[model samples]
Target: MPQTDLSPISAAPGAAVLHDVLIIGGGLVGASLAIALDRLGLEVGLVEATAPGALPAVFDERNLSFAEATVNALTALGVMQKLRAPTGAIERIHVSRAGDFGRSVLEAAKYGRSEFGRIVVARDFGEALEARLAELARLRRYRPMRFLGLADGGSDTRAVRVADVDGERVLHTRLLVAADGTRSGVREALGIGVDEHDYAQTLFVTRLRSERAPDGTAYERFGADGPTALLPRGDRSFGLVHGVARAEADAVAALDEAAFLARVQTAFGWRVGRFLGCGPRSAYALTRVLAQALTAPRAVLVGNAAQTIHPIGAQGFNLGLRDALTLAELIENARRETNGAGFDCGDTAVLAQYAARRREDRGRTVAFSDGLARFTANELPLLRPLRSLGLFAADRLPSAQAYLVGAAMGYRGDVPALCRGGTQPGALA
Candidate 1:
């Protein structure tokens, strides 16, 4: 995390921007990847369509959950300490079904951890990423630019066609990374098809002010409409994500604050007390997008561009950060091999290694998120009793609680070095 003087724009106007690696997107994942590479003294270029700080979609507004492991990784990478916003800790999790007979509680202490995770607004996180990106002297940023085309593939040196403020430009690099969000242009240019599933659900997000303050606790209540989550925020307000059918989203959004609070109270009960006030509401259609492959020759995908899953487990962004960290570690080593002779950061070996190592983690996270979304929303009576039994078991049984707690904390199989409280290629930094 040591700072260095940023390398000047290595690529000239109307000429190829030459670098060790070129990132096609500069969102959270993409920007962090650039910073991680800069820490290793790699010449990196970030191509972003939007100017810094003014991001759209999930980049702002909503309160986001950062798995304990994810926060540790970002902190180790010098990304978290720079954030300016206040954050809350999730010391415990309460899970139950509306009007169900049983409930489950997962405590961080049960797993020998101080807290399960931390919560912060997307706006604050966006600001942190920008701050880090600005300090990366090794990174050359190309903003207000886009991936206009892909050229020089199937060649020794691959070049990406980009359109930016300098007009038509070309970026030649050993690798092209597609951190370009779900509608990824690089993914499309690579002809990489994605398996997408529309959950037919829309999530309404807002800040809730309850009469009784949350005590470092988070709740997930599953009802007929969908799953509702009340996450503890730093300001003592609860961040709420209420899922409803697509057809009902508009009607729900049109409801006034009082009516909306009433609906939430009815679904969640008095567990968290009365909903007093709430901020403006926003809604998002839920869908899962997984690319058929994680990498292609001279190109790779990371973050949301690789997989966009249901937000139930808070795994989407956490998993994406892993993708970035994992890729950075692999690339850092690749640069040292051969004593830097004809070193290729985009070598097939690196891509293959990344794809192999990420396969299990990606599969597990996607399955966990998708399964939670489907099962909790299923209205079948036969599943109700089973769900109740499962929740109660998690609450009562140590092994059951451990399993859920481990996953939520990002402590699953083959955890990345940073997540494990260790560093990979640490000597380089």
Candidate 2:
């Protein structure tokens, strides 16, 4: 992403730069939204806190599981074609619980899919986003800028105060978006409260090479402590997410490479061959953060600022991308309806429609992630039989398998047009 180095003229009291839509964050979701709106004939501005040539913490070494719908949306936005790194295909998923007799398997071939989705390293995806953003014809990027707070504005627009290297200035916009992480300043400025839940678990992510290269099958094994997942990667290694009790996380992290591999092998069993080499592990505390409302006045929330869910089902970024695409679709429709005569992007009806369209998808995704995280953590003996039976039913019954497949592929309510299979960039249908 190329950022302008010229110092911007400080706006006088009544003179301010205005945008059709101003996004507060430039992370994964925010950047995606900026790219979507770029093709829609809107004057867009992106506030990125990170300076040029430096990657944000969100683009760490962790691996991201993209649902099929997410893959389609990114491809449609021309982001996937810019990726420098190859992605791993998930052709099959195997799910089971420790000390249980039942197991479930989902195959993409059975559902007429070449693969459920592709897995990309977060760092690689971030680089792809930058490449795509650089190609946008009309996106204004404010790098190394900090959003101060909401400023005074008329009823039709919102005034946002921000500080850059030069100085502080106010920018006006018809729509304000909060794509910042779990703790969002824009949401706070809008007086939108959040509901939080701590899972009391620490997730460790890393990569491991086995005697056998991954055959495009992902494994999810749940134990009393937590769930351990291994996702296939393009480099002939498996991306690992291991969950452990918060109290025991440090000890697990301090283990020697051999010891760590052994523990994972014991927990996950020898589905693949023995682990040969392991990479450095990174730990993150698991928590679910949900905004009380999706919109307030002329502003709205997307990505983690809207809802941060457990990573058990690998639904965090996939759901957030859906949020971004849905909003972009709605804004595109509004612009077309007015024949480019300049309609209100922040009109109450537009925000209400966006909120209503997102409710079912967001609520169901949160419930699935949160419920799975809690359900697998409980080891009550009385629930053991129920768990086994549920797994059996899910594996045997067609309806249950179909539901799981739908969730896995992100075919939820009100999917955006660009999220459909084979959608081209800038397509309306």
Candidate 3:
């Protein structure tokens, strides 16, 4: 596809400048959306509050499980090939209670796939994506920009006001995509309300050099305290997500390397053997935030702007990626049908169609994540047997296991053409 050149709008007052899409926030979700839209030959502008190259690189930690579907999307976008190292293929995943003998194991063999998915470090993933973004000629990147508000009462186009460290400016576009993080200005400006539920827990994430090689096996262990995860990374290290009460998060964060390693060893048991060493630790609050509505007149929200789910299943980023791809597909279809004219990509019809397409998958994921968090955290003795039975059943039923795996991998309900490794019939050249 040929790149769209977007010259800067003249500074003259009342000058009309336009883009096919204006994306707020340039994190992974926003950036990915920019690339995807550009691939469809749409003129896109990305505004980011942070400066270029500002993403954090803590250690060999913070691994993400990219569903096969997600991998396919990234591969089609030409980002996956630039990964620093080969991904750790997750052939299997095991979920169980710390003291319970019953467990649910999901394997790729039964699904007729080489692997359920793959795990990659956050830093490497970010690097590969950024590199791909650099090569895209159609994407316009505006850094250090803060979204102010949106112009109301427009049917075909919307104006977005943003400010950088230097000054404020206005941008006009047919479609405005809010890919900003949890606290999104576009979502707020659109009068969109979010239903938020706090888990009242904090997640401490870090990297550990384990005595045993992970061998592409991911483990999730639920205890009375909270859920702890061991996600495989390159080498012999593992990414750790240790959930604890909010009160204990600070103390845990303050622990020295040895003390922290001791605590992790006790909490996670010997499944991965002793933690030989630990890296820097970070903490984040666990909460679920779902936007009551994803779209308004000439705008729509994607990524964290639309919803923020708990990290129990590492679904936050994966879901955000899916949102980007799905929106791209919808816009590409509309653009092709209109021959790149007359159709407002952000019109109510388009926005509504996008929302309707996303409703079921988003609703189910939020419910599943919220329910799983609540179930694992619940100390009620009466629910223990039910939880055990559910796990045992999930283990025994191949169909059930495949369903869960497919959902986790972003393959449920009307997957996008690119995700299915197929091209849309009328996709832009």
**Residue-wise lDDT of candidate 3 within 156-254, one digit each (tens)?**
688888776557668889888898889888898989999999888998888778889888788999877678888877666787888888878888888
**Off by more than 4 A, model 1:** 1-11, 424-429
Note the residue pairs that clash in candidate 2.
none
Please write out the lDDT profile of model 2 over residues 370-399, one tens digit for every residue.
888788778888888888998898898999
Instruction: Quote the RMSD, in angstroms, for model 2.
Output: 2.1
Cα lDDT of model 1 by residue, 1-429, tens digit: 433232234233334346778888877889878877776666678887786546645576798899998888888778788888778899999988876689888888866888999998888888888777777655777777768878765576677777756566566888889999998989999899999999989999989999889798989998776789999999899999998899998999999999999988888888877889999898999989999999988889999999999999788888998898889888777767665666788889999999988998999999998988888888888998888888889889888887888888987766678776665344242
Q: Cα deviation of 60 in candidate 1 (Å)?
A: 1.1
Model 3 clash pairs are none
RMSD of each: 2.4, 2.1, 2.6
The local distance difference test score of each candidate is 0.82, 0.87, 0.79
lDDT of 3: 0.79
Give the 10-residue window scoring lowest on summed lDDT in candidate 3: 2-11
C-alpha-based local distance difference test score of model 1 = 0.82
**What's the CA error at residue 170 for candidate 3, in Å?**
0.7
Winner by TM-score between candidate 3 and candidate 1: 1
- Highest lDDT: which candidate? 2
TM-score of the candidate numbered 3?
0.93
Better of 2 and 3 by lDDT: 2
